[model samples]
Target: MGLSFDYALLNLGRRPTRTVLTAVSSALVAALLVCTAAFVRGLEQSFTGAAQPDVALLLSRVAEGDVLRSSVQAGLGALVRANVPGVAVVSEEVHLACNVTVPGSDGARAAMVRGVTPAAYQVHDAVTLTEGTLPGPGEVLVGRLLARQMRVDPSRLAVGETLVLEGAKHRVSGHFAAPGTAIEAEMWTPLEALRGIARRPDASVVFARLEPGADARALQLFVDRRLDLELSLLTSEQYYADLARYLAPIRALAMAMAALIAGAAFLGGVNTAAAAVQDRIRELATLRALGFSTGALWRSLAQEAVLLGSFGALLGLAAARLFLDGGAVRLAMGAFTLGVDGPALALATVATLALALLGTLPALLRLHRLPIAAALAED
Candidate 1:
């Protein structure tokens, strides 16, 4: 409707190829930002959701005692129960990784094995024993995903099926699913059962639940005062966040890669926009000679750039969605599904607009310094 709109259309019509290329470049950058941001957010949510708000975890300073280790003193569990008031129960955790051969497949895959108390089910609702009964000592409960990979019907993985863990036999007593969480990739066994396999009397970590009205900081202080045990207390929420730190290096690397890719795309898009603008110099000069204001010309150029960016963005987003929806990607320490959330989509849209705006920068600067007489004479 406006003079600027008309001018933009004229320029684009004169150099359709360059305009399209600029748009494509913008779209790619936008898509990468959207996807990377979504990945970081998803990982954060997954880890935080894995732990409960009120629960606390106790670990030795010696091993950086978290779920990753194999040993903590068996007597220490009793000491925490005696000293920490309003403390519910202390559950020992043992972690192991082993290879299992899937039925009908000669290949083997590694899986995580966790040992926890029966109270773990109550302390952490995210962990649900979906079918069959909890594992007795020398028995184990596996996650649904692992069950599927194992090619064993979870319901049919009865108490007597021999499950080999590091060449030792344990019965498959149960199956569980911690939906949308990393725990789904693991199997559970009793704390005592893991002692021998762990080759130590100490469990990996002690998970504690504070009583209602108990001060978390106070409990932590009390535990801190006991210098002999070398223990540290972390609330469940903080614990998971801390654990996520391990993945930070990889996430940062992904972001850096995305940035590099996006930067290349932006540079390419800018070059395209510059080429497109150069081709339309004669037409733009004609408009100015015919009394089109500088502002009008500028707006028109910006609009054209924006359109290209927007179209590119939409195309890129469509590509990402089609390829990533429900697709699984491996992450540091775990794997996650690609989720196309509202924020990610919005980021993509913004990227498209930004690309267009950036593309117009050089053209606007050039136009400001251009000689009207020279521009007109070129035509």
Candidate 2:
């Protein structure tokens, strides 16, 4: 008869300490894998999710695609709507970074701020005013992740609190959230109010939303025909895609860390498997003498490994769900929450089991050629 799973379970029970140790190691590795996947997934979502197919941008021809340094006439939005055929709405917007001070706070914190008219809400459809009304004159709407993004306390930007910007105090109107998009880290204000405060007479960029199935070429053609306007066009997809590439190094670093963690886990599994094999040399030989094949003993060892890994991976998943799931992390690109979703869990499980199986390789390699006669004669 072949070795059954019951035999494997019995072997594990005999070495309580060894089984617990290996299982614990597997759990730690699994938990870390979840964290890595969450970070990389969250970063990609923030960029890609912000890109909308129907939207495009107007920028100064000399500024390339960078909006921060771009400037155009203040009324470009209305001009585009009146001139372009396929355009449905055009929003005049200004994006800038400035220092904001909360009352009773020690120092000013720098944050990204956007100035926009009501049309901006339609162009950036991802944003939802979850907590408060749209911003009015001398008022600001903070994003849900603003506290983490700015590395400031959440209480500092609470509704009804006043924030000082450019020596002018503006009340926080409410909070908004755009899940999986970077806009959740920014604060928005009324277009005229912010323009007055910053003393900027021109719009930094024009955001245009084209009608469904609208020819995007109309936007390009409009800008192309008016070389005198010194304006260029870029799709929202193209801009956000470039931003994703610019941040690739961070993802690469996270994968590198994962590789290192995998290496450690593999080595640990191999060591545990080797020790168990060595300790059971005589018993394994006894089984061989009892008409059990070398293959059966090897399979029995693999089954034992699978059991330990499954238990450990499950424990790790539980701990991660409790502690790390939905947690937020800050980066230079603002903040993003951990994505402990199905894919991450699947990846962690597969990695753990695969490593467990591979860990049996060295010991299983020597099993077939084992000197059953000599092993059985041992004291």
Candidate 3:
């Protein structure tokens, strides 16, 4: 006959301190796994979600992944408009992915600055002005989430405030909102004014909007035919996808670190289980004398390990939801919120159960060789 479920639970209660410590260790490992997965998944979703299929990004061939390093002639937007068919709008902008010191901050922080023309509003229709108006020379507009990205109060970045960038003072003229896009972490200024500040004679990129029924392949072919431009074209979706691919190594590193921690926890659990089995040898021998089979005892021990692991897994999931949910992690591109979704929780649970089973193997093997006579003779 199999060991009773109630008896298996009783075995865990006999050593409360050891059981609790082992469970806590498992919980820590599970939480780490969940947080790492959530962080990477959130970043991927943020980048992929920001892409608009109807827009094409034009960059220098050498700056395919890093827009800040890209520089093309300022007149490229005009040239594309004149040469490419099915082009609805041309939004030319200068991108500066630089570090700036905010007022009351201790050190320099990374920020994205865009030098844009009035036509920029036409192409990026998702951007809506929330306050004030379009910026003129020496003036700038801030994204609604820029304050959050800088880890500052929103009131500090209010309209009429001054933002010092590269030793140049730019007055905040307005605030804009671009929901579900990476632009939410950026600041905008007049093309001529930012060009002077950046000391660049060219724009970093051109964003072209396609008309209805227009395809990006035709635009690519058009750019390919223009040998003089030295330009590369990608759909906005493809651009962000490439950025996600470039940052994949960071995600892999996070997962690898988590796995190492989990492996240590698994070893700890194995030791804890072995000790518990040793301490219970006499009791198990008494049960064997009472007609319980060896298989029944082994099954009971496995159940106890699973029970302990499940408790730890529940605690870890709760901790992840309370702490990691809604937490924002910033990367080189922008910031994305950590998501403790259903899939993350499920993965943590499965990993916890697998660790529990693996941890019991050594104890099970020991039980196979345990002589009922020897165990019963112990003090």
Candidate 4:
């Protein structure tokens, strides 16, 4: 039988307020889930890219979430280099989650600081010196984004421009960028600059870079043999994965919020669909009496729901991209940018369409069982 889609369209238009409410409800939920999912996934990317694949990290397995809390003697940095044949380079770097005040052209704001050795640039190849020079004792290299936020030029941040770190003033010597990671939002300094606060009697981790074809497992075993020192060995990838695991609690919380919001949306959608069908019962019954097949009626109802849901999905995704993109939030790893990637938009659309399918089911069944004679006789 030929379909009269116009009939369904006219019915939905007749009840404009209810239709609009349903659409708005679906849009709100889809937006929340999309933005939250993007932010959580973005945090993962920020930390993962910060880690170097060719590098192996040495830390205490007993240490908790903070790498700064993990301690390996400074001597081990040298020993790991000398003992491992495949190792090409090693450095003892210090990392802190503390905040610092930065002076920018726009004004001053608080941001995270990262202290690293000169070899940090070597291991993290993407860390390019964009301006001025490398950091020396009592000096720092601010990240490109952080420097911009602080309104200070790399070259202009003269040797005497005092940057207070945990109440101690350190000079700005250079500026750097880590391309696409959140590290670019932090300030870098010489490991010695944080001496008193970091209490680096021991280094946070002994970072070693391996030569090509060198098996990380073999190297891990080699370092694991030094369990007497209670040192745990891991490839940089493992360390990144561990960092993701460290942020699992926050991720879980994000997922929980998405679930709650999605659940409410689903329920609201069902109610809206049910109300749309109830209000149109007489018209639908008239169609049945006039010889429209139950299957045809089902198709029309499902099609309308899909159309409404698709509109809501598109609206939600657009909102996320326009409003939430590049939004930053603080996490244990550091502050990370919220990413609204293609996959996230696709997921949000699919999820909303699925909910539409669910909402359409009850309405379809209600129309199918109407008695043609009674439907036609009804006022």
TM-score of each: 0.82, 0.96, 0.84, 0.84
Writing each residue's lDDT as its tens digit, candidate 3 over 1-379 gives 5778999899888888988987898788778878987877787776776687899989988886568888889989998899889999999999997566667666667788899999999888678999998999988898876877877667768999876888877788999977546677788999988889889999999999999889888779877898687889888888889888877898789878878877887797688778877898898888888888767887888898899889988999899999998777766646667779998888888888788878888887877778889999999
- Model 3: per-residue Cα lDDT at residue 308: 89
Better of 3 and 4 by lDDT: 3
- Positional deviation of residue 36's Cα in model 3 after best superposition, in angstroms: 1.1
Spell out the clash pairs found in candidate 4: 103-150, 104-150, 104-151, 105-151
Per-residue lDDT of model 4, residues 147-222, tens digit only: 4444446444554466666666677777776754667777777776665655656667777888887767756776
Error of 3 at 154 (Å): 5.3
Candidate 2 lDDT, 229-249, residue by residue in tens? 899999999988988887899
Judge candidate 1 against the unseen true structure and give its global Cα lDDT, from 0 to 1. Answer: 0.70
What is the clash tally of candidate 4? 4
Residue 11 miss distance in model 4 (angstroms): 3.5
Which candidate would rank higher by TM-score, 3 or 4? 3
RMSD of 4: 4.1
Off by over 4 Å in 3: 117-139, 143-155, 158-160, 172-184, 190-192, 199-201, 211-213, 332-334
Residue 297 CA displacement from its true place in model 3, Å: 2.6
Q: Which ten residues in a row have the lowest lDDT in candidate 4?
A: 100-109
Over the stretch 9-124, how does candidate 1's per-residue lDDT look in tens digits? 66666656666656566666767776786776666656777878778887777656366653557767677778778887767677767665434345555667777887677777
lDDT of 3 at 334: 69
